[model samples]
Target: MSTRPPFTLYGSNASPYSCKMRALMRYRRLHFTWVPLNPMEMASHPNPNIRALKAKVIPVLEWPDGRVLNDSTVIIDALEAEFRDGRTVVPPAGPARFLAKLLEDFFDEWLMKAMFNRRWSSEVDRDWSGRWIISDQLMSAPELVTLPSPSQTSGLIKFFRDRQVGRLALVGCEDDKLWQHVMYEVVGALDMQLRSGDACRFLLGPHPTCADFALFGVLKQLSLDHTAGRFIQDHFDAAYGWVLAMDDLSGLETDVDWKSLHMDTPAVKKILKLISAMYMPYLVANGKATRGEWVEVEFHLDDGQTFRHKEKFGPYQKKCLDDLKRHYEQLTAS
Candidate 1:
């Protein structure tokens, strides 16, 4: 076995979580390689570039010992455990740590909903998805690649919007400028609260912690597109710039410039929940009860499985962690 620390990342250049992981690797100087994922493929298929790890999702981190960790948070946790060189990605313990997690969750899930809603809501997104999101090698004919229909687009937009009903959802009624205004305000609020009169320039101080990268990940996503992406780059320019600094420290590879990568592509339009929420409740219908308990939910993407989802969650979240754990235990039982 090679004694060198083995780190392999399964993610795409466009994935924000992947970017977050990349930023972490560079920040801490962790060693790792990256793998990109493309749809329309099986493990052995000559096309689709790469197959998704769990139902075609990205950001799967594989360790040198062959331990595969899914979800950005979980992977980050794994990094902290293995890279115990005294360099900490989180504060020394206190309210700062708690606040970091809360706010990170808020921005990661909520803000993503708003930003991508606008990106995918346009005609530009529809045309672009064809060019970038799907896999060309998977299909014999370029025209054969399928995309979400016009009506599907409208429904997806509405789906994200409606899900924000109860949450402190903050996109401004489908208008990009309004959305930017709100986004800028939110970032300002975080900057004020975290740094409030402290000598620390980062969210905690001195060292970049989880809070710093968490905010950066969400903000990075916001800045991905230049056309409708002016909110973070324009209003929160300083804070947005910090994301690059963190990315340098992080160990992931990102191709596009923060200010220049946004385009009208179907991939940009589609808002994906983190794999962690795969079992979480998702919003499906208005005025309906969602998969209230995490223990009962299991998200499926296939035709028969997808239909079983209750749209009542209104983009709600659920996770059957215990059940999954039990199942895992059973499978490994001797």
Candidate 2:
């Protein structure tokens, strides 16, 4: 049993990042309480700490001392430092570690477009997911004794669905053709990796890494929704099974040698190649655009395709790109 005070995890089932952090905490064997919160109520939450957070995002980790932390990647890193458990999502320092970070960022930023595209694009998906999300929030209410009636949540569901659909273009999900192609290729690569051998079960190696969790965050939603779930079930069985395995790995044991962790497999190389062709150009272009008053960010992929987003440049992604570069530069010959 944990001798320390239990941390409180404020999140929602509708959120992939929330799911990601929750699974990570379980895998690390951290003592914590899961408090499902309504995403719509985050801004005016009764807890001062939630309201005071700069970014009103889910999976907010409230430390035992009452301080709060947001951002799944940031929260994972913070907890890795605080907990001394042998189970770590991060690999040892080396090229493998850097590749892990790269894959994590790629899933978080690029592949996320696929999840958003599928979740809010179709009428069937919109109606089902939106209603389910609102109902999830209602069920989490402390005073609620039974399932929430649709009459009580219909308006909120419609509002939430419309809001998400309206912002689809901002996140570059408006181009269905582009994102669909990207998703298919990435999932194919991951499926191939998982089927190669028992050693290739996880992204980096036999043990789960931050990259695996990052991919889990986006794919978790994909495996839940209508369209994307069908695609995974029908075409990528290995990838689909991998997602279920990653959901909860609390009992998983890690006895592999750290030196064996690597990123040279054929499937991993293909994934890296895709990242170079897709995410790298977008990162460089966004970094340049965010530094100035740019109305849209445009970049050309290695395959002679162009991606153009009319939304304002994203400074957070720019920071992610910078961090990746810094980490790459810090690596030395070994």
Candidate 3:
């Protein structure tokens, strides 16, 4: 039997980040109890440790000693440090590690727009997701293993749907046409990467990385929603299959041969180009706005179109950009 203390994951099934952490923990073969919680109620959670969380986000991991940690990326890194097991999500340190981190951020920050847009933009998806999420929360109660009655959740579902749909512009997902194109391009590139060879199954190599889990977090929803799921099934078979494979990887084991891993595939190149065109500009703009250089984030895409968001700037994203830069600066010129 393993000597590691069991963890308690407070999250909801509807949350992509929650799914990401859950899959990461599963892949690491860590013993943990999954406690599905509604995000709205997190601030007033019964557990004092949960209530003390500064950010009311899903996938809050509670260590056995009662300490709590949020942020999926931070939690993954912490686990990687705590567990010296061979099943690491981070690639061997070097360019591969940096690339993995970059791709992970790209998926988390940019591709997520596609996932959110598809989920809340359409009538069918909005209704289904709202009902499903509320039901998931309701059923999370130990006393309620079955679905809640519509009458019990009707008002809550409508509130949830309208609230999410109302924030489309805030998250820069108001432009359905742009996000649709993004989804198609990203899914296509991922399909090509997956089909490149057996070694290209994951983003960096035969083994999965933090990047793969991050991509899976967003793609998992895309493959489940009504509109995007159908689109993915019709156009990107390999990408859809990869999402399923990433959901559970406890049995997956591979030799840690860092020298064999390569990130020069055509699909990766395409993804990097896309990031340069889209995510990089956005990050730069957000960073500037965080530094009071601008009242809002405004950047031009490679397609000669300008994108602007007047909503509150994401300080966390600016921090992410800074962190990426710091890591890049630390790399040696080999």
Candidate 4:
């Protein structure tokens, strides 16, 4: 009965970015038709808009007007701009804004390694989590969701397991222990923030911001995937609560008074310190290597653990760093 044309979204359940965009759009009350397609199916989608995905990634949005937007971050940014009169996910202050953007990058880029590790590093995890994804998302028969030995299940398992396991090295944490190190920093630091004096429900405040959704994407997966889900439930109750809260968009309103929240606090400081010490150094090394020089970066976490990785310049991460600097500069200037 709605008048607006249905927005077309193509994605898969296993993609965190897809979940990110879906949750954001749902929270915004934007009516969109979701097309859940596996990687092969998505690429082969007859619609030229779906076929022309920029990053060849899922959660591509085709606007009613025939515009195609790829990349979850870009999609959210565009939606926020277009719907200025509606509820927004971006915080409205400079410091908080910058911090939110930084945290989004941290969650989306850096913490994703931990997520991947949790999903693919263990056979037990792959069997538990992969079965659910393959059954519910990839297969046409919902009744086969719990079946372990479907003829197609083995091929799908090998396909996903091999691809995801192969990606573990690219994430800079070849060992499970290193992945746990990153997870401890992220989950522990956020738990501290939640327990702070103000007791903000979301990362920035009561309202869900870009940071919250960015983290929510991975957290949602963690809460569903067997290994990471158990890890959060066992040790990071606060984080688990935040993840559930982000999934709810019951009362967010466009006309609600936006708070003048800032990100100057001990918890924020802790996260920034960790990012600067561990992640920024990695980005810097990667950036240098992007200029045709091979560089190795070492990360020293607060818990006295260290890991080193040799990486070439990454265009994606370089752009992320550049965007952060640019946004921070703009915030200072304004």
Candidate 5:
């Protein structure tokens, strides 16, 4: 029998999957030892972490009693099933369980594309692309992974953009005047439920359950609370506060070494930057700002008088918005 404690984690702290378990345990206050793992580390371990798991992935959980777990959902569920110390991620399993699963997968898969695409987007100079690229730009770059060929990444992006990803996102095709409103509404709904009052912190209940952690994974993609756009303030007072309670997971792009970006291409980078810039403004006009709180972004066409969304925004607004349509279409089609 291994001398390790009842909980031992063979994974890296930086991994999203790993973080899912870590965050769950953090709120639950479960004690576990994190045994670090990477491709290289796994290769050398004749113990064969891969052989035990059908595929290559991180965040394998091994209990001190000699039980091993693979897959984040499996691990969390197993823990919830076997060890319910009066704190559960959900009430007796039912529709809530299934909804939690769907939400977790949504954040993990669908949101990843937008998150990936946003990284390369910036008004970066040409010279900087070569120097900064993935390696230099990252706050803590992963070991340079020999990812699939650049051509392969392009193919995947094309496939993801065209066929695979958007089907689920468009399951809720919005016809709102501004897309940000629709996006934040969904976020706001979840936040409102979680933070029933200023004090009600957990999204589901007293402690974060699997459902809560799953939502956290997706929300992590959006920027931090300090973002210029008062996305939280405008949409729902609790949008930022609820997420903050879960520990901010929004700052993932800065630390990852993403593949498939053509940083050398200035136009592409500008497009990306444009996408990010639009988010703040989009949040303002479309999201939580009531008419009373709203400030007009443009002057009246007839008079110097300004108005909120109705007239202040002009051809320039239309121009920027038109540009956004193409990007959203790209995202939607993806």
Candidate 6:
């Protein structure tokens, strides 16, 4: 008999990271309770769990033994190690394993700006997302479960819009096109790779890996956001189909051995080309800036496009690169 405390997840529907954690939990077939938070609770709740997170972010997991975990990547990594013998989202070893982590970081970090802009840049998206968040999250509480008046809804939209716009500006994504371009290039690459002959149902193989789920979280949001959904349907329909297939968790729960599978293949290479060409330089420059160094970088993509940016490094991005390197080192050592 297992005495492990039941796994509990705290997050909001509006959070892509939460969706990532939720989907992974579903794929793992772990029994857990989801505690979705409304904006009020997220901001003002007195829960020590929230304070313990330090970042005040959702998608924080409460482990059975009373340990609280933060960040989707950190939470997923810890859980994957704990349940390594079960249906896994990462390869046991090899280039495929590293590629999976890289793709996950790409989706989690780079794609996030686009995801945020797509949802908050436009008035239509802002209103839609605002309504959805309030309805879905607030309704769970008896005291907060009523439809807001038109005026109240407008107020809520403005409130969210102001906050999100500030975020976009701070991230240097004030120009919606910056994030839009990121979305366009990534989806364009994904479309081509998925249509390639060697393309599997999932990114890494026939099953979903961290790469697939990480991308899935962002794509799922894009599919739901009125603006991004139309863009996906109009330009990269193939990638949209991949999103639907990855949503099926029941199909992934099996005894198949990931180590026996050949993971280094053409499909992965195509995806890696985009990461190395477009993401690596930016990541490197960002890392240097984090340590108080100034940098100007020119990043070129596999499709012969180039982007040059002069900026200071970001702390969070520095941590992302460090985590990726740590994982790579561990994989090689094993």
Better of 2 and 5 by TM-score: 2
Error of 2 at 122 (Å): 1.7
Q: Flag regions of model 5 displaced more than 4 Å.
A: 1-6, 12-14, 39-46, 112-114, 119-186, 191-200, 221-237, 248-334
Clashing pairs in 5: 89-209, 121-272, 161-334, 166-334, 234-288, 235-288, 298-312
| Candidate 3 vs 4: which has more lDDT | 3
Candidate 4 residue-wise lDDT at 32: 88
TM-score of each: 0.57, 0.92, 0.92, 0.89, 0.48, 0.86
| Model 4: residues with Cα > 4 Å off, grouped in runs | 1-3, 140-149, 196-198, 253-259, 291-295
Q: RMSD to native for every prediction?
A: 13.2, 2.3, 2.5, 3.0, 17.1, 3.1
State the lDDT of candidate 6 residue by residue for 1-334, as single tens digits.
1245578898777788888888888788766788876534655666676665667776878887768887898898898889865577877677677778888999988787679889888889887877776667556654664666767667766786678766765554555645777788777777877787867667656677888789888888888888999889888899988777666585555674676454554545655666777678778878767455555667666566666555445788888889889878987887
**Lowest lDDT 10-mer window, candidate 2?**
290-299
lDDT per residue for candidate 2 within 10-72, as digits (tens), equals 888778888899888888878789998765577888889888888877789999999899999
Off by over 4 Å in 2: 1-3, 146-148, 291-310, 332-334
In the range 165-204, model 5's lDDT, one tens digit per residue, is: 2332332112222334324534656655545443334433
lDDT of 1: 0.48
Off by over 4 Å in 1: 1-3, 39-56, 125-182, 190-199, 250-289, 292-316, 319-334
Put down candidate 1 lDDT per residue, 1-334, tens digits, no spaces.
Answer: 1247857776655566777777776666667776564323336434233333454555667677766666676677677776665455643334444434444454555455545554455556434433333322223333445755556555544444344332322221243443443354456554444344533455543455665676677666656654445655665555665666666753433331222222222211122222223322332121234444222234454333231222223332223233333434544552
Q: Cα miss at 36, model 1 (Å)?
A: 1.2
Q: Candidate 2 lDDT (Cα, whole model)?
A: 0.82
- Candidate 3 has its poorest 10 consecutive residues by lDDT at 290-299
TM-score of 1: 0.57
